[model samples]
Target: MVLVPLLRGCVQLLTLPIHVLAFLGVWDPLCKTTFPYFMSRFARLYNQKLHKEKQQLFSNLADFAGASEPLSLLEIGAGSGANFQFYPPGCRITCTDPNPNFEQYLLKSEAESKHLHFEDFLVASGENLHQVADSSVDVVVATLVLCSVSNVQAVLKEVLRVLRPGGAFYFLEHVAGDRSSWIYFWQQIYDPTWKYIGDGCSLVKETWKDLEHAKFSKLNLQHINAPFNWTPTRPHIIGYAVK
Candidate 1:
């Protein structure tokens, strides 16, 4: 009886890749309708662990920007508006995502909250932020976003365009790792599977190099080993830069 159950588990694990591969070429069914729902639910569950890091990053950004409350902030690729929940009080926050489904949960959450008021939610992409005015934003935050953007260089240019002089752009991202043969071997095999299931995430992006090439003013890069409750993987390179 135990052998039968164990064998079933093993089979399920083996077949997960097939399911993931099917979803790769096809647009994510989740992105169509269930994306926001899944994101909201997952955010609530994952927020406790992830939010602390986000808050810490935000604090660092505030210090770097030398701004207090009531600051003009833009969060590009702000899925499900998780950042709003952690933002400092008395701020006019603008959160944008390409997915329209994000409006329901994001707007609803803000409506019920007294402190975190959102200015708007628009359908926007990082590569091209149309509505945001140039040199108007004090701080631009991108957390775990670049790996999936279609054009990273364009996105940085857009970010640089929007940010006010002496403003900060903060990031928390995992990049492609060093030349560790073991890590490389596994990443090579499973990268496709991971990207398929986790949207357009890439384990091979040289995030640090890209940022350096972008020539953002006063760039500082830091690497922190992200807490892994599951399996060991590459360390995340968290970045903070001024424009």
Candidate 2:
């Protein structure tokens, strides 16, 4: 019953080159090519649940907005287009990320979808999504995004602003652990170092509190503790919220 260490998880270590390059401030070109390529493989591997949880999430998303004439989705951190398969037919995707290096991989994923086409790829960060027009998109997605942003509140505000009325915000993210546990102490010690090499991922982000404070009228959120048993900072929240 031994779970793999967090450092060995597909996401925790992204790509060794990307981290070392990030540390050196000289790996952008290499990261754009190598990191995205490697990320896609690891992401899918890490996401293998005992049941089809993600499929259900995407199914619900389709039911909510898929019937419209032209449904659109703005994903906060569309890393290598990992969610492309889950998208229902005819959903136009607009992906945003601070690293413009992922453009090639995103396009590659778009082509692979053959169902969800690309709208645009914005070279922007989650906290500042000014590139997207307010109240324009039908759905906003942020899987594994809130954990890294410097200001989660600002990101929530932008997500709300960009979403059309009745539009839904879908997310799946990990967060801070219990205060009394040794895991919390480990997280405190490792967070800064982890954030540096793990692409700004904060091991102890209290993102559930931010989601609670958001102006969403309806939220069907649930906790995910079983699948992420591999790490102490592995408490995850996943579901949809309607604006």
**Whose lDDT is greatest here?**
2
Off by over 4 Å in 2: 1-37, 66-68, 226-228
In model 1, the runs with Cα more than 4 Å from the true position are 1-30, 63-69, 229-234
- Superposed on all Cα atoms, the candidates' RMSDs to the truth, in angstroms, are 5.9, 5.5
The lDDT values for all models are: 0.72, 0.78
Writing each residue's lDDT as its tens digit, candidate 1 over 12-100 gives 47767556546484446554476678767766655676666767667754453334456778888777766666667766778877777
lDDT of 2 by residue, 1-243 (tens): 123345445444555655666678875455445666676676776567523767777777765564465678999989888888888888888999887777877788888898877888899998899989998888998887788888999999999999988899998887777777666666766675577545678988878889899899998888776365666556778889999
User: For candidate 2, which ten residues in a row score worst on lDDT?
Assistant: 1-10
lDDT of 1 at 132: 93
Candidate 1 positional error at 5, Å: 30
Model 2: what TM-score? Answer: 0.83
